[model samples]
Target chain A: MTSNSPVGQDFWDELRRTTQARIGLGRTGTALPTRRVLELAGAHAAARDAVHIPLDVERLAAQVREIGIGEPVLATSRASSRDEYLRRPDLGRQPAPGTDIPESGADIGLVLADGLSPTALDRHGAALLAELVSWLRDRYTLAPPIIATQARVGLGDHLGAAARVRTLLVIIGERPGLSVSDSLGIYLTHLPRPGRTDADRNCISNIHPPDGLGYARAAQVAAGLVEGARALGRSGVDLKDRSRTEALGPPSGSEPGIQPGHSPRRR
Target chain B: MIHRQQVSGVTYAFDGLVEVMAKATPLRSGDQLAGCAAESDGERAAAGWVLADLPLEVFLNEEIVPYDTDEVTRLIIDGHDRSAFSAISHLTVGGLRDWLMEMAAHDHGAEHLAAVAPGLTPEMVAAVSKIMRNQDLIAVSAAVQVTTAFRTTIGTHGTLATRLQPNHPTDDPRGIAAAVLDGLLLGCGDAVIGINPATDSPQATADLLHLLDAIRTRYDIPAQSCVLSHITTTLGLVEAGAPVDLVFQSIAGTEGANAAFGVNLQLLREGNEAVRSLGRGTVGDNVMYLETGQGSALSSGTHLGVGGAPVDQQTLETRAYAVARDLRPLLVNTVVGFIGPEYLYDGKQIIRAGLEDHFCGKLLGLPMGVDVCYTNHAEADQNDMDSLLTLLAAARVPFVIAVPGADDVMLGYQSLSFHDVLTTRRTLGLRPAPEFDAWLRRVGIVDDAGRLTPFDPTTSPLRSLASAVAP
Candidate 1:
């Protein structure tokens, strides 16, 4: 329909005014430069390079052993078509049968994946992994390094459940932006299992080279989630509630100074 | 830094500074190379791609190296080359930009080629322009392909954005319903309220009643002023079935009187003629919702089921004119509170684009510079209220927003408060009746006292309403 329709015209005029007002406000300081974009692109290029190089599977296996990882599981899948992947999100989340883990009970199940941004892996994977490993070592004993290729963020649930781990933390590439195409995202789940919802997971994103969320920080956050999940007996919404309570100090109810569930009785 | 090697009738002076030359000379023409070459009997050949006619001025670190043309040709034929000629050839215009940047770092001639190429003589410029254009096209195509590939990769794995997931249980279905409802609500709030008006089957009628009950008890909403819109097929209107009149009578005192159903005519037209027969006398306060068809006034092809009619700015205006004309009779005869077009699909670009037209201006034109515009379903948030206010202000139309439930009503009030703070006055108003209160109760937002609270404003239930009004 034409813009002259009552609603159409109103929406146009309002959108224009809102956009103008936002521009006039200049709120975000001229949009900070995004380093993640560059790193993501660089990482993608590196991943392509790695794919082309004659990969020594044996060498990769040796590296896994060196890290003291036990037998790790692997998985892969392809989009129905390249275009279908882009236009329809409903199709993207459907995991192949064997790809999903049945249950999770391990201390920590590490999953490697090529998310929306495969290039992110090449750029930040090494540093992020190193950081995650080092910090995780300080907290809990990790199981074998579970490297799942071509995985989505949700895959962590299955992997965690299958490994029967207390927690599953997935490191995957994020979708590339025009500027920062190769950023990594970490998804952590406590008591991971299939059918776990988004609220059940926590994410630390924009992990890339040079000033992104490093592995050490990610590991700390992940460890907190695992420990909290163990205490709360749940993750996602429940975990968030517990964490918030801890951070904010028990909602002001347990204190002797205040009564429960009422705004402190006004004087 | 200079070294000399003599071979056959040529004495080649090679600088020790050049590593490639030093390695090349000993293997090709040296006495040690001759002995080894004789023993191998041409069974093994030197590796790397060889340049047959090496440009004389080509230098490696200020060193000069000599090559035997025949030997270089043989080496090239043997498929031993280190040059990146193939990589360069595959480079498109975008690729060439990178290639040129790399080359210009060390080669002045390459720098000159990049500099002069943009503004060269007619013939040379034309050829360069053609290549650049082709390369640009290729780059665009590749970008599209890459985006598609990324989407496919994510979709096949079922890992699309979490936002699109169903909003129920832990998820918020109100937010989801609001998104669908907002498209209908856009400019009108006081004039319309969406009802679950299903009269199709006994089961569907029961579902509608249950929904009505939920809206009533949950949010404390009044029933008289609202209209029901159904996404599913219309229930058959039989005596034993839940007659619309009987249903209204049943919840007459409660907020049920305000509700009406949204009809899906396309689906109803296919059902047993009995359903269509019900439409003859059954159409009362209920709206006849029909999207535009081709050859109609509004003709933008963007709308989902408008029979491929274009629904851009002009077409939207024309559609408004047509709606004003055709629906006026039905509205006047029925004494309905309002008449509206069936729901507009997302991204129609019409309502936002056509507010200035006299057709809409005159139709909605009210006294005191205030038009009684109805927003079908709106989120209760400052930004949503601000957006609606801004749109209304632009049209000089004072508007009301129909909140589906109590949470929405609270947010709507909060949005009003925010608007007062931000705009120095409240230009928009909230109209949440008992029907909305009932919905609130169903959704667990309101307590016995009819109060609601959301935990996080950024990700609050209130914000879900705001998204419904998002452009």
Candidate 2:
């Protein structure tokens, strides 16, 4: 109907009215004031105030290299233009020719991608990386993190294959939103390679300032995923099943005694 | 000591030492002893303390009867039908339409179908089978065509062509036609966005329009819902001095070298603006397809090749945000995004990386941008309805279901309707209304008899109709 119609005038209105009422009634008097107080305190501060210095990509890449880190491989796609990139994904998976990769396998392969949110990378990439590296160090003998630039999600697989790492983690920026779009996401794969499907990867997303999956937790989850992948041989559903079964007890019996004509199945 | 006495047919026993035992003994009943034993068995079962006396085979086989022939049959039939239906559905809309072209050729004797359908000769039986398949496809295609037409007729249409295909790796013509119709409806009585066939062939455009018209007529779309004469294009703005008041473009592919953001933006800003100045719309009101552009960045770098650099997360987010923000002010009533590849790096990351990160995060982050964020190319095979409904519920926004292949619209519609029924009731904790006026508004349906009355569920003629349909 017309846009001018009031709520409750039609089925959609009724639905909206009911939903709004439910949300309103359910969340009543449960609002937190701490966030508002913190927001007010941080209002005058610059977006970059949290960090001591601005990030220098070239310098960071060099430093990562000079620290005797693994060889830095550059990720580029044959879809040299945007139109081709959108239409052709096969091109985005392969890396450019002549990019250097370490002769021996590294402990971890670090890939920095623009992902959907490039601007977000400038804000959350460092903290996410730092947290990730620290967490990795705590758990395993970490080879220096090899930061691959201008990479895609699939590029991580290629880099991982080239580096021969047990796990490849790509910390890319998430697309910005009105509230907190500058979030970072971590995508990890065990035994990464080209043509690797999404089922082989796991991600910890929304790593940003507020209302996000924080770096420490994300790192822990990533580490846990790596360890689980090492044991389980893959990520995504495989790792999820392992983690879930570990958290809860395993199945008591082969048959769960689930019977036919049960309401549980019907529902 | 006991003594037995016989009285008629009954025998009674009495103890000689009864008087001596009465002071020292208590009465016991057989029924009470039996009840105690049963209670002990129940406790043992509850505690899973199996007794050695019980046979394992009894627990394994006798206690459990897993087979339910009725359920198994139903499941098998349902599964078969679903699979067949899905295949048929895809064929009818996407493949059937393509087949229609082949059929026309066959009718003209350009090609033979013996290669595709080997066993079936040009006999009547094979012909009937082919016809039946076509009919099934047509039936499903009609349902999809009708629903889309009805939605478009009411004016709540969004980008339809830009969605991903379910079976194939490309867009479906039927789906695109439906979307084009929807766009035309939204742009009714005003100029709106349109797609120029990438091939740029006049015959292709004509054929597309003809097919669209045939589908519309076959489905009996209302005469008032007329198809536009020309497919509107961004290029058209340049030719016409009367450039549209505004243009909204999505920055999805801006990050990768392959995206069209740079060229598109340059054209819109420099070329289109040079022809005529157009103001950008605010975030919530803007209408465009920016979701795919931004979402693509997840898997691929930016259109400008800036993605691979060691940019900090903030910088990346800000740049993406800037793209969305810049496009936000220029958006119109409809904004669409890709939920499949662009927003989601992969299918499994729905909560963390997919919906949460790209779709909701990016759209919501845009300053007052996107009245409705369309999630295109959703996983139709899975029970993604809940995920989609949950995301929408969380965001408190309206959405459209985009399924691949034209014939699968019915399945999509059924899934959406089911989801709406379950989620609306569960989340809102309310009874179904006579009419979902808010849904109509979101989709843009209006009652013409009531002076172009907007159909608000709270107070609309359609309310009674919707109420009648409510389960």
Candidate 3:
């Protein structure tokens, strides 16, 4: 970042250390400096490439099996191709008709899908699944993990229904940003079924490693949400993530009861 | 009435008004997804030709979204100013286009356009936009100006404002403060200092609102602050005495789509009344901040038009302006390209949608701004955004959203940066909102002539802001 006054450089430096925001970039008559412009271009190139990259489902399944969570079951969303997946979101939320998924009726279901950023799912999916399953298996019966291709967040609903699990946790790659292209996200839904709106799910996003949410913290948050969902008999807007406030425990002293659905708001 | 046209010995007939409108819309991925887009360019041209010949009064008679099913439609039909419409009462859709172009070219065109703004329906506005070229949209939009005020006046000629979006992934107060300080040094945030919280919890929203209020009051900056949360969250916060300058909601065109958003006309009305009753304004009481986008209705599975036919996304987007106009919002912007590539596939489609939204909103009498942005998955880059930003600036859009470096870490999208805004303003000889410009000079962020001074963060008056949030 260029500073017009060299004296202010140190203060800006101190401030820049606090946030991920690009704060101190020096301007050249309303244009960004040469390096900053090129930096953004380079970042955008990576992110744009990440969106089109396909996840290697066989490799990801092998990686998940190595983690010893459960036998990885291969699956595909109704969207046959990436182009179709991007255009028709409705198709991405459902499993392809007649696809076989053995129903174990386990207490928890896990699905690893290649969302917008398959590269992210390919890179971090196994590690995150391993971390999250460690916190989940001892307390609940785990079903076979489903590896979904060309999926959206809602794909978990169909896969979870097929598994007949009480709760579904979808660990997927989030849409890439210029700053962080490989960030992963976890979505939790209780009693997963079709027709459940975003209100019926709670999201834990931006979980890449080192710089983003570390694996331990992300697993902790997911376990907390799973526990909260089981206690409340539901998820979505009614369930709050108190993982940051306290350790996962009983629902006593926590507001875990059915409440009316709250509307979704975003920028 | 049957809508048909002949193209090279081919008879193209549409099922109804909605079908005609949909087929005539500039090609976009959203309409194609909905199975309503024209099958060929010849069909689209034929449909446009038919749409142009339809009388302006057809909008008054035909409903795109059924009136009984959608309150937004009811608002347009009920609130239409017939007296104001009398000026253009006899014009066809094509006639209205020619008239607008002629008036825009005249010295006194702005007055004529403003005079009839109240009479125009969103359908009429959307229809004319479908027939107009990008340059026509720009020229007509530039001729019309709609202004609003809270602490600063916006939409005055020779001025462009920005909504400083200081978002953080975890809502860390110190991180937010740093970004806000950066924007202030660049003379941004003249439209409003708004935040899109990661979570919609009322408590978190209230805390951010409080943080912004504290900064706004401490520096006595001539601007308003908003925490964009659900209307219910904002309403509860208002009841609990939170510092709310603007009540925000992402409204849609149809009642079902809005209901999916967990909002309705009544809820918005209540929120508007609740925020206004707080008496938090120095310049005016325009407290509502409304946002709309093209594909929200279709995304929600609620974009039905006449005979259950799918309405074009752009028409649905314009109908949202009817909702915004009724609320008397201080700011109404379409988060144009934020919905991803499914709706607006590429740079050409995104730019066209941005201009169309701004044009329709201005013609319908709203202080419209555009979030000139794109998601990474969308086939767009910084160059696309630069093109859109320059075009919108040329159209004299009331405001644009500006992040620190065009990368919104929290929202995970790209938008115009502070430097981008400065570049547009300097290149176009525009200033910030009047009060914000005065405050900038008073605080030494800009010179006496309202030009940005070399920012010296160490001696800057805004150093107090850093210290306040400093650990």
- Native contact fraction, candidates in order: 0.00, 0.05, 0.65
TM-score of each: 0.30, 0.35, 0.92
Worst 10 residues of 3 chain B by lDDT: B462-471
TM value for model 1: 0.30
Instruction: Compute DockQ for each candidate against the true complex.
Output: 0.02, 0.03, 0.44
lDDT (tens digit, per residue) of candidate 2 on B1-471:
343434343444433211111111111111111111112322223211112112212211211101242221122223222322332232321243345344433543112322222111111111122222323322221111101111221112221111211111012343344333322222111112222232323334344334434433443332211111122333353244322323334333233322423433334334333322333221122333333222333334331111122211111222343333333232211222233333322223232222222222222222112211222222221234445444433432222322211112211111222223223334533221112223223334423211113223334332332133212
Tens digits of lDDT, candidate 1, B288-348: 2221111121111122112221112222222222222222111110100111111211112
Q: Indicate the docking level reached by candidate 1.
A: incorrect
C-alpha lDDT of candidate 3 relative to the true structure: 0.88
In the order shown, what is each candidate's alpha-carbon RMSD? 27.4, 30.9, 3.6
* Candidate 3 DockQ, CA atoms: 0.44
- Work out candidate 3's RMSD over C-alphas: 3.6
Considering chain A alone, report the TM-score of candidate 1 relative to the true chain A.
0.60
- Give me the displacement of residue B134 in model 1, in angstroms: 27
Error of 1 at A211 (Å): 2.8
